[model samples]
Target: MADAAPRLLELAEHALSTPFPLRLRAWDGSEAGPSGAPVLVVRGRRALRRLMWRPGELGLARAWVAGDLDVDGDLYEALDLLSGLFWERGADGSGAGRAETLRDLAAMLRDPATYRLLRSGLALAGPGLPPPPPHEEARRRTGIAHTRRRDKAAVAHHYDVGNDFYELVLGPSMVYSCALWPEPGTTLEQAQYAKLDLVCRKLGLREGRRLLDVGCGWGSMVLHAAEHYGVQATGITLSVEQAAYARKRIADAGLADRIEIRVQDYRDVRDGPYDAISSIGMAEHVGSDRYLEYARTLHALLKPGGRLLNHQIGRRPVRDEQAYRIDEFIDRYVFPDGELAPIGATVSRLEEAGFEVRDVEALREHYARTLRAWVGNLEDRWDDAAAVTTEGRARVWRLYMAASAVSFERNRIGVNQVLAVRAEAGGGSGMPATRSAWLS
Candidate 1:
């Protein structure tokens, strides 16, 4: 016991010395009591102790799930602190190497029991839990399908599920994208409302102006825009179920006069020169090859000088092609046929297509918080979720939630919501003075 105390102190000191100052705690007095920070205590030295011998990369994660670790403050903040530790490393120093060491330590801390339970549950859950096919295989399969079918299937497989299923997890507004944490102390709900309002403000929506919501799911933003901003909203979605549910929602909200939901592909959309456009959580489906086409379509649809907001997932800069792989598990279980392009790539496409990039905000940590909340909601309604999609789907979601949590935790994926404006050639115009002014 005496020897364990010094070793634990050394481990804690190592973690603290890193960019992420990790605090340790124990359930029993075996390791010289808690040092006033979060504590992670296991039953004994033989159990999951080896996993924590050094604050390995995933050590804290394994400890949290095994009931061996508890955080005194915010979980997201803890994760942010951990991520900062990894990011504080620069090219000229030894910090980068130490960060790598922490990551290696994290891998060693995996709890076998937790891994086993999660794996077993997913195996029972259904076809959705299949391992992702190789990236080439996925690309080939997608290419074989007609472009329209490919797009529709991609959207349907993700959003055609029962609206009740989403309602169970998402807030009453059913806004599934990352909530914009505008100020430092904003609550989730407030941030979400602010996000919706921010979108509306960016679009410069006004009464009688027609706003197009491409790939709109369940019409949450459509209703919000119409009701709050007095804009006439038309939402297009490839998912019939989503369109149908959104129509009902619109009618129920007594917004049939101002809002409409249509089941149509974005390519087939020719409604008109919309005053504004917003595609939230939809651009991920616009494959890298089709990004240019998407930009052209938006350009053609928007009225001269109109603005468009694109909120989608993006990949960080990868040193080589090897760094990018079609995450098979995500493809097979979560978003079939989805692809995430780098933000730079998307911006290039927009610029080539004649749109000016106005603002870009990375909501990486906010998305982590959003996913965490979703996981908590799913776990809280595990029985109901199991009933809706069967145990296999439930298991698939469980795997997805955990994997996604780790992905964001490790900085593998990011969310960038960009605002771009259509600038007509030969038209004299100045950019907005302050993008932040819209937040006010």
Candidate 2:
């Protein structure tokens, strides 16, 4: 039984042409590898079989979601170690997505050890058919990308993962985007409030103004703006669950008179000429091909001189931008059809859409901290969260959030707020002359 771990590690190292970085603990309670390294607990051969058949991000994701694979120590340390091999692959070629992508199968076909490797890997995974994907796994969508119907499905898959589950994870604030941490001692709720207020300030929300929040999650932004800034706020989301949850929250907050929550897609938004617009943590779902359209839509919807604040997650720009592929695990298990663009391209697109890009603030570290807090909340209430959402779904969020936190920490990715405005035809931008007003 103890040989199980060593054999699996040796096979993995040989096949991948690299050292197996994490310690391995096999099903029979066998353990091997560096004594102090983060331990990857393989509960059974099914996890190995999943990895063997899928050979990449999806395989790893399937195993994790199904509970066949798990981490025994600090998740960040384990994922950070694998980040170079299977985590953040960019133009530097750090080997992301799949082990097969890194492995030279053609070379292996010519290698005499290939047959022995295959046989050993097969025997190790044991006798079994490939495991079916977990029920929580999203069904892959078909047809043209970013169609309103497809977008709605995508949103439903991600955001409709039950409001209670989100509440357990996101805390009472329900502000899913990056928080604006003013100080180290700031609580998550406080940071979230600061973030909403910051967006309101940047957009210059005021009494009697009409504000639109695109992809508003659970009504936090609209409620805050309407209550604090006295604006007539409208929040639109494709998720029926989100809309319902947000509407109820707004009613409870006694802001229903000022805020309107609608299950509406951004493209279908007919009401326009808003004084200000906030698209927080939403544009990632707007697919790269539709991003310019998204920008144009926001520009067209806003009044002249009206500001638009877009807070979105961003990836590092690779030398060959066209080569970018959405991570398979994220696409399948998490944000299906979601895409992240470099912030520079995001600014360029907004400017191309007739808006003067006024400011770009990177809240990368803020998001990292926010995710850690959310992960803590989830970990603290793991049973409650898992009860509302399946264990598989909970596992997905855990890995996603923890890995994202590390990604932000290592600068592999970031979240940024791009503030822009539709300049008046006479070129009056209506923005304050100095950054002090906004920064303050």
Candidate 3:
């Protein structure tokens, strides 16, 4: 009997005091907002109650995961529009930071219209207790943040979501890290190959040399290094599934003799004096508190003059580092307990661990393109992926990757390859006068 969509939009806009720029379609088929805008579809009353309970990012994430909320139009365009209002760093005046948002909420509570908004929301939500979080949400949270046990759980939550699922999303290469595109039209597989080759080159991997790949996801790095560079490689990862998958891939490629895949923690690694060590896309999981230990562990495991290529994700530094917080959705559902540091801080920590920081190359744009490609893969095979994993799990990956693409495109975060070497006692870093030797 009620046309709920228009009233819902009116209440939301009045409550936030900012215009709702997109379309909203209610469960009863009533629609609101501009004619051509992306549509936010509310499939059930549960979506509103979930948002009412948690208010910000996590609430929306839960709704989206539970399938109570969905977008009927372009996902990226909808997310880009919403990011300015709910997320973003508030630097460009399109978004508000926590302090500003809190002030705005306080101001809204004082407004008489907010009472009407609250009543409308309650009537729509029509409630029982908020629906339980989706089964796909990350659960285990017993041990210390980055301790071995907890770290394993965290890695498993994100990576052990079925290798078939990742294969569909990551393509044939199966490299989860950012790819290096030589040019715009490069295929994802080609870019990924280029990225692996670049790291091997930077570390100067050669025949008969030992290379250790810390946090080697699915064994892409080790396989590439051994096959192309003629190196004996060992790859370590916390995910059992990843290790198994990598081993199978190595066997299929006939490179098992040249590469070893182990499901072992980096701290437990004892085989030392490796000529090259690569920690690609893994350092973000090393909590800031344990970063020094991480760096030192790799340093101690490397031969003097051995190169450590830390291909990691970096975040933009803020004025007050102490107050910094990881994204709630990312912490709760995606990479649990993961943290990012500015490239400057990462380089400093490596240097403190007796590494001479050699090169810090930011590949921010490349990551945007890589993420976009991954998103395309997932979108193209959405049905098959959801069948492999739960729909909620697939949704989480889609949302995170799409948002991350926007984040990288806008420079909110970045990916960098920090090439550092354990300088020999004489202070020589293996004597490469110019990058020309490795650029090829």
Candidate 4:
């Protein structure tokens, strides 16, 4: 066992040499990498066993979820540091060869503690380790993906976690999507309000107009539109929890008559001919196969000359082999079945569905900023957030949001608000001749 500490240190030294400083601490009190740096604490032997069996991001994620792995110091910084090493390894095709692998095995066998840990890890069953507990794997949605029933389950899995938890993370403003930060240093609430107002202006919402908010999370847009724009707003979502919370919010504002929240799919919304539609932060779930259907559905639901704002996350095709190697950890753990299409695909689908694309704005930086705000909120109110859900679930959000922020910042993904209009029979979109009016 005395030799185990040094052998483990050697393994980390060779396996995880990063450009930036990172400290890896094993459960047996052995340390590797730069001393006094950010600590990646391996809580127990189980973490190593999990990593050995599962491998890659999923293994690391499971270990973190199960509380067998953790980091000391800034979580975001630690993730970034670790990602640098992972990306570097991915860039170099050559991994540990036969000789190096044999050397590691020889060292492990000579050390009682390391040998025991290796034996335990190898004893685990074929392919991968047992799946994480039900709670940890909750994000792995069941049934056919993107169907109404399956989509409902997926939505419920993510949004129905708890309104209180979301409230803490989203703050009082309760806007979940990317916010328009008109100026630097604007608070989340202010930015969210600005974003809502911006959308209203873009859609040209006004009194006597009917607005439909598809996949409206907690009625933020619905309430904002009804109160500020004086539009008769209808918000629909598959999550029963969101509907309940949004309905209460509408009632509390005494705007129940002006705003309606329904737990229904956008496909089922037959009460059509809406004067305007705002599908904020919802289009991502409208799978690639159903994108045209989504565009056509919105087109049919809107009156001629009515505008539709389809806000969604988009991905620029990854040309970097290293980046492309990282699979969709988000789908497995956070937004199951949520698919991000390219902005071009999105615009083309709308055009094919008889929509005249008016404005296409990419708020990639705004989304990164918004996610950072949410991450800050969650970290600040971590105790409350953790209480609302399990620590594992909270960890899931923290990691997912932080990584997503980086992804957005790096142009790996983008959030675009595509404003398209249903042309009248005469082909008039009824749009302003200039973008100046919307800017105001």
Each prediction's Cα lDDT score? 0.68, 0.88, 0.88, 0.80
Candidate 2 residue runs with Cα over 4 Å from true position: 92-106, 438-440
How many clashes in each structure? 10, 0, 0, 0
Across 306-357, the per-residue lDDT of candidate 3 in tens digits comes to 9999999998877667767667789888999999898999999999999998
> Candidate 1's residue-wise lDDT over 218-304, tens digit each?
898999999999999999988888888899999999999999899888899888899889999988888777889999999899877
Candidate 3 off by > 4 Å: 88-110
Q: Which regions of candidate 1 fall more than 4 Å away from where they truly are?
A: 1-142, 182-188, 425-431, 438-440
Pick by TM-score: 2 or 4, better one: 2
Q: Candidate 4 — which residues are off by over 4 angstroms?
A: 1-21, 35-37, 85-131, 139-143, 319-328
Candidate that beats the other on lDDT, 1 or 4, i.e. the better one: 4
Alpha-carbon shift of residue 47 in model 3 (angstroms)? 0.4
Could you tell me which 10 consecutive residues in candidate 4 have the lowest summed lDDT? Answer: 93-102
Model 2 residue 406 CA deviation in Å? 0.6
Clashing residue pairs in candidate 3 (N, C-alpha, C atoms within 3 angstroms)? none
Distance from true location, Cα of 419 in model 3, Å: 0.5
Please give the lDDT score for candidate 1: 0.68
Which pairs of residues have clashing backbones in candidate 1?
Answer: 25-39, 25-40, 56-105, 56-106, 57-105, 57-106, 58-106, 125-392, 126-392, 132-328
User: TM-score per candidate, in order?
Assistant: 0.68, 0.96, 0.95, 0.86
Tens-place lDDT digits, model 4, residues 1-440: 42333455555544443233567676667766677677888776677666665655676788887787788877767777666555433333333332233235567588786666556445422255455542656544566678998888778778888999999999998888999999998999999999999899999989989999999989999899999989999999999988999999899999999988888898899998999999998998888779899899999999999999888898765334233332445666777788776798899999999999999998999999999999999999999999988898888888889988887876667999999999988998888778896556
